[model samples]
Target: MTGVNIGILSIQGDVAENVSATRMAMDELGIEGVVSEVKNPEQISDLDGLVIPGGESTVIGTLSLVSGSLKKIKEKIASGMPVLGTCAGMILLSKKAKDRVVGEMEQPLLDHLDVKIERNAFGRQKDSFEADLSLEKIGISKFRGVFIRAPSVIDIGKDVEVLSRFNEKIVAIKQGNVIGTSFHPELTADLAVHKYFVTLVQKKN
Candidate 1:
């Protein structure tokens, strides 16, 4: 509550949107915390939780590695720090990724979550769409999900828990301290996902 600090990887993507949604989620839950955009590796140390937003995975991964933040984030996640990764963020957190429309892609990934993801599995940027998800584990029956050039989990390891699915495809998953979603929860008015993530942070803190 009091000393909770959440960071959003700001290398690219919906950095501001995630921050705003996180702050709103904290407020709605009557929790106290600070949400900030994290750019440098040093910023990762003080964070109780982290959010990797939806954006270009290649660019975000390249920039994070170059800045040395990728290693730090990997270390933090391995150390049991709660993380919420959306869309491209989900790709980075995945153990492996392949481009469904384009073919195999060689990109940097944290590989924290034990799941195989298919990049652009939902379609291209123009194919971005919205759907309602039933994340019963997170206490939500119908949550609006925004899919923008999204990826879906094609394979999941035993440790991974499928949170939500679309058309029988895995769209959201959780494993220990890491949460990954192919859809962008920050793009919608619903704060359930963020709130669930905040609870993860709170439990960790």
Candidate 2:
């Protein structure tokens, strides 16, 4: 498909990295598109797909909520606009989130992805690590995962499919057009996941 427009939630996190990866993914897939950093509801309404990059979940969610972008995103996702949420982005997309260190706390969340996420499931910032992950659902037999203060899926609805795992922990999951990852795909060089998302957007568009 041509003129596929994608956006990265730029309220917080790796906006530049996500933008670059998305552009690369679109180019690699030979899909003509514009990848922009969007933080307002108006900018979000035009997106074919969106990437909620890894960042501070609380801050991102709160800012989006205050700016009315969160509601707009939920509406788009409900309308079948493909969304890829990485790390903190995954937390915001979840129906429930509890930080392992502090348990559950009030936070604005999109609550569109039907899963309960355990924030900082691997420990704290110092515990961040990378590993080789096999995301067979995305046709990736082997992929490098960059986990930094990542969140893991502890509970999922019937529609949710576990895509990848590490140390017996759920790191990646998908429910229809919504994809969530506990690792940062943009931080890595692999384009498999991003390219797959681009194709998903193209298919939906």
Candidate 3:
């Protein structure tokens, strides 16, 4: 592929790790272009796809809103830019977020994915752990999912397809060009999810 530009939103999250994983995934596929930690609206427009890494949802939402990237991101997603949101990123992408540990406050949400998410669905930081996710529906054998104060998809709209589930709760979902996961795929060595996302980007391009 030529001139592929992917960005990992670095407002407040696991920015560097996602950048490294995305770059590695693109390199593995022999795709050449740029992988950057995007923090500004201008940088966002150059991106073919965006990755919102797992982090403190409240902080990420508020900071990005104040920085003016939140509105830009919402616009880009509306214009059909592919996006992958993991962990707290899922909260930002969700249409509604319930069960917030902290009291509800105004936070910028892209509302790209038609789902209701519950923040800290996997308990607190001490409850964080790794699990082998069976994403058979997405054609994956097993994915090592890292859950760090993750969010869970409590409800998904009819247009959304449940990609993977843990127990009875939907943990991964895809709707059109948007992908959202409750666990962190970048935290693991597997890059299938990221590669799958790139393919979506390529198709959209």
- Model 3, stretches more than 4 Å misplaced? 100-105
Residue 57 of model 3: what lDDT?
Answer: 86
Which segments of model 2 are wrong by more than 4 Å?
A: none
| Alpha carbon lDDT of each predicted model | 0.92, 0.93, 0.86
Candidates, ranked, TM-score: 2, 1, 3
Q: Give all TM-scores, in the order shown.
A: 0.97, 0.98, 0.95
Q: lDDT of candidate 3 vs native? A: 0.86
List where candidate 1 sits over 4 angstroms from the true fold.
Answer: none
Candidate achieving higher TM-score, 2 or 3:
2
1-205 per-residue lDDT for model 3 (tens digits): 4767899999887898899888888888877778889999999978899999988888998888888999899999989999999988888988888765764446678777998888888788899888898888778889998888888888778999999999997999999888899999988889999888877777787
Number of residue pairs clashing in candidate 2, backbone atoms closer than 3 angstroms, sequence gap of 3 or more or interchain: 0
| Number of clashing pairs per prediction, in order | 0, 0, 0
